[model samples]
Target: MGHARANGDRRVHHRVDLDGRAVVFQRGAHVGQYALENLSAGGAFISGERELRPGHLVHVLIDFAAGNPPMSMTGSIHRVREADNGVSLAIRFPVLSADQEDAIQDAVLRTLLRREEQAARLPLLVFEPRPRVRQEIEAEIRSFGLPVTSVESLDEAVRELEGEEVEYAGLVIHSATHDRASMEVVEFFARTESLQTIILPEPDGELNDMAKRLSTLPHVSVPRIWSRSELRRALRN
Candidate 1:
């Protein structure tokens, strides 16, 4: 089972195929076991023996076999339709905490990477305050045939990193107008072993001192982005 979409679908979150089992419950009574077909951060589709009507509040324990404990959540039945084997129940999660959302995203991303071998390479993250510089960097990164994601602020980048399970290959940070708090966040990402981070400073030496301090950090590169070759070499390294 997969996403049940119609013509001209306008879904916000894309669904991923999931193969697992769940224990269904309704009205504080145990119903039966169901097969988890497809899943997204917001909802999932499960096929069960008994027919469950829409608007029925249900609890499910998703067997995410990624070394973590099973995910238990409460949701309501959004819709129901006929399936090949049994009836399918569309479950909609109305509420999710930050940890819960991260767990689901991690599970989904793991499943996708397992299915596709080439998906291990994560996209490049560009954190630039200047709009023109951000656009230029994104274009240059794309020219290298690499996928990139750009964020205007450090907070936005942090949110994206925490909310999604996608790993980042590298980070290009332009810290011209960023405050101390933002610089601290950049340094945190720079020191991460999983990503290669390059810090670009303005011509006025705005971030020169910070760059010098972070020179001793591992996987961190300081480069002048004005020179195309220097920037390219840093990204490649």
Candidate 2:
């Protein structure tokens, strides 16, 4: 919700510019097409002459590019600002299902990849907020002769994922990350047809319930303890 997050400059999701349009419905009535831009898995920004009040609930059918059919979504008007031409409204998506988030993320990735861009060479992205744990993760990655880009927060990791110069091979997240925040980031990664691997370092005899919970997903792995072979298998899969 970059458009509405006024408290800080922190963004855990990546935003991409879109040549799209939104068919917004207010109170189940059609509000017609509004120009759509700055779409992310998290939310979208729509601009039109119509002014939607903040906190108004709306359903949207977004016509994103790349020959894909319109995708239905729901959001609330989180922020509104008057522009020289008209008003721009930002939608805050809430309680999105994992599938929905993955779809939007795929759409964003396609747009990014279609701009004559080359995928960045594979590197392991380690998101561990704890210092000692972060060091161990880095050492593990390097032991496999893999390049590592480690970060201590979701915001930093998202920055790395969105950057054009670094395509990640895998993501190794600590089990200790806040459950909500880690899942939000992980949903963007564990795709159905993903080439990227995601590993959650689930140490034994610890309060890492999230590690076990997330490992149920198709592309997420949770090795109870780290062994070079086990970690290597998770990273390469």
Candidate 3:
């Protein structure tokens, strides 16, 4: 059978302000209507009374305003922030057929093009540089049996991630030396497909804040070592 065709010329490459679209947020047999605002490859930003926290999986249905039939898919809320005097969710959709995937990609590209056009006239924000901490951190990563590539710059790290063939199940990011840089590494792995991430607290640094923040992320697997053995047994069973 051929992949299903999306109805009508509802352009997927453009952001349709979903304020009036018939959007539904659902988990299992439960369902509720949500105010869907924007959509892209990253996810849908929605507002709802339901407690849709980050990392919670749900099904979404959207009907284009121009009489196109509804498109539906499963999605996970990856980020949440308060807006419109209410909660706003960033939902990431996975598991789409080729046609659906293309539609989403086209939409995202269009949105990005618009953003770039606007940003061309605005000043870009830059951050302070990350200090050198490769040698000190490499030793700790090695002890975990993970391979190490000690790069002096984020540019090098990005290149390595794009080309490196290392088979790592998880990446442990240390908050040593450079705080912003360490979190940047964590964000990189989190965005990478199929890669798991564990944020290791800075050995010499305080853990109270890190522990609180890490506890909230779903992609983050805690007690990293403990999960490994448990996962193996679960798979076997």
RMSD of each: 16.2, 14.6, 15.5
Clashes of 1: 0
Order by TM-score, highest first: 1, 2, 3
lDDT tens digits by residue: candidate 3, 48-153: 6655667778888865443334667788878878776566777777556666756655544555566445433332111113434445445544444444455555
- Candidate 2, residue 30: the lDDT equals 95
Clashes of each: 0, 0, 3
Q: Worst lDDT window (10 residues) for model 3?
A: 119-128
Candidate 1 global Cα RMSD:
16.2
Which lDDT values do the candidates have, in the order given?
Answer: 0.76, 0.74, 0.52
Better of 2 and 3 by TM-score: 2
Q: Residue 183 in model 3: shift from native, Å? A: 45
lDDT score for residue 105 of model 2: 72
* Candidate 3 residue runs with Cα over 4 Å from true position: 1-22, 103-237
Q: Which candidate is the best by lDDT?
A: 1
